[model samples]
Target: SEQTNKHLYLFEVLVKNIDINRNLLNDYEKDLVIKNPIRVRIIFSDFYDVEIDEVKDCKSIHLPEPEQVKCHSKMSRTATKEKNGKEKPKQPKQKQKVPEEMMYVKKTSLHSQKAGFSCLFPMEPMEMLEKLKTSSLYFLIFSNMGEDEAKKIIGQAKVDVRKNFIDSVQYASATGEFPTTANLTTSCKIENVFKEVSGRIEVYVRLSCFGKFIMSMFNMLYNERNPANKKTDEEEKKAETTS
Candidate 1:
């Protein structure tokens, strides 16, 4: 399947007080490393705003599948036969990597001494839209900060009608066009706040314009099949009204 440069939608996500352990020494007293842990949950749905019940009870969303992946041959073809009429030994075939749904989380800015987060979905619109519906998306209780910091943030943040108001700085990264602002409404919470935390934690949620994706796909297919149907600026208006 052919792909275009246009992104399905853009998201702006950020985390604060991300540097949890500012002054921790290693076991050998050689280097400072992050020892405290953070946990995050991301939720996606068709509602304009998600609810606390939704995030906690919802199952992980299914990602789209590849349309036309090319499987490569590991070894080059050998000659039909050797001079003595025996086939030459061929190199062993290598395994191909299976494609998986992946998202990248990048730190975009440093707040005071804290760091902010960014995430991107780098797949095509067709594959991306297959499993998605239009509307609300939520990144819940996500933190680059430590467990204590994550707890504080989630606690201070206010939520009304299944929405959380993020008073701290956060926004979506720029896409091909301008990035849209997130309407602060939806349920969000850090997973396992009471339990001990450990390891690298990152989360992402995206709300895409499914209607636009449908229109774009229709236009692309229609234009490709009937190139002659394309009209000039003047004729386009006439065709629109007549059709």
Candidate 2:
């Protein structure tokens, strides 16, 4: 059965955090301290040939303010300044925390048509694996929605599909123990699976297979609705009978 041979790849992308650089904001925005609601737009590219009919290409989500933390760098610089005309020795570099106003956090799933489920990618398992190697996801952050609903871009980030996803699946296929889940943390620098504009993004990914019986039923209904598919199926059935 063709349906039995095909595999459905389901992907769920949960965006966790976005930390924008303070320098990226203009003088007016910096003083206001990001009071406007933050919005994120997500796009998955170079992956599935066909997305679910209900899945939207540009999925947007609103983010709440992240937990605040004092800026360590600013404090350190101030503390280390010359006192009594004596220069203070440089100390070890301290990890800088993103300012509260510049950080946004929202645990929302992207590309999902339902509460917990995302769009299904119907294809051969091998083909899906190959495609996953080159797939990518893009994130666009926006703030300050105007009266016309036009969003101002703050920054952008890109993530590669192969990081924790494809490698785990490949290992599972070889070892026959598929975990069907992976986690990725984006960095401040723009690289594979990293964030850009000095921001961070964390994502939890889930993958699952669709049942064969359900796929068969879907195909049957689709063939019934489309004359081309119906004609092809009938011709195949006739050929099978003659053979």
Candidate 3:
């Protein structure tokens, strides 16, 4: 029932707007896009492994808010200081990692209203779905749902939303022919492959390359920020001291 809800709500939402949000494009955006428009990301993040057990109160939804696109317009990524109040290291790397923060889809594009939307870009890749898959996340963990053509589609669509919404979007077709459902399936797989290796997207190939509805995997707590979900490090440390 929860999975059904997510499919209905959050996933469908991202499918529609991630490609283009009307609010992000104004007369100014529309005007500049005609000339030197491009997408901008205010946030840069590192990936870390998030176990299903470690996940906290990150908001899960069946659909994305069309309005959140506007809210993020004023959003800026501030590099948080370490708990010790020290600067973070530059070029940190791990053999494997999950994302440090729950990624928000925001992009600022320099393109036009006619060319289409302007908004914050998705900041990172690989760690989102790749983490989910790599860790084999089990949020009620259903499986063998009868030949999931939808699974791959849902997974891949999120990547498109992240890339296209964040960067730039352009549409084209090859050899001037209508592609088919099978074609779409193949496209999803291909995109996943490209994205996995380089964390880069092949958007020109993705425009009409896949499914009608995007997959939204919204359900469950996401981060540790909510008071309900949070246990401050100091409290934990104090407990350790008493114990």
Model 3, 1-243: lDDT tens digits are: 222111111111111221222343456544433333122111112332211111111122121243332211122223547889987644322222323222222232221110111122221122232432333111111111124322111112222233432221111112112222111111112122234321122211112221112222121232134544235544665887999
Task: State the C-alpha lDDT per candidate.
Answer: 0.30, 0.48, 0.24
Backbone clashes in model 1, listed as residue pairs:
12-171, 12-172, 163-186
TM-score of 1: 0.25
TM-score of 3: 0.16
**Candidate that would win on TM-score:** 2
Q: Estimate, for each residue in 186-229, the C-alpha lDDT of model 2 and write its tens digit.
A: 54332222333445555444565453444566778898899798
> What lDDT score is found at residue 240 in candidate 2?
90
Name the lDDT of candidate 1: 0.30
lDDT of 1 by residue, 89-182 (tens): 6543443332222212222222111112223344444444432333234434333343344332221222231122121101222233333333
State each model's C-alpha RMSD to the native.
15.9, 16.1, 22.9
By TM-score rank, best first, the candidates go 2, 1, 3
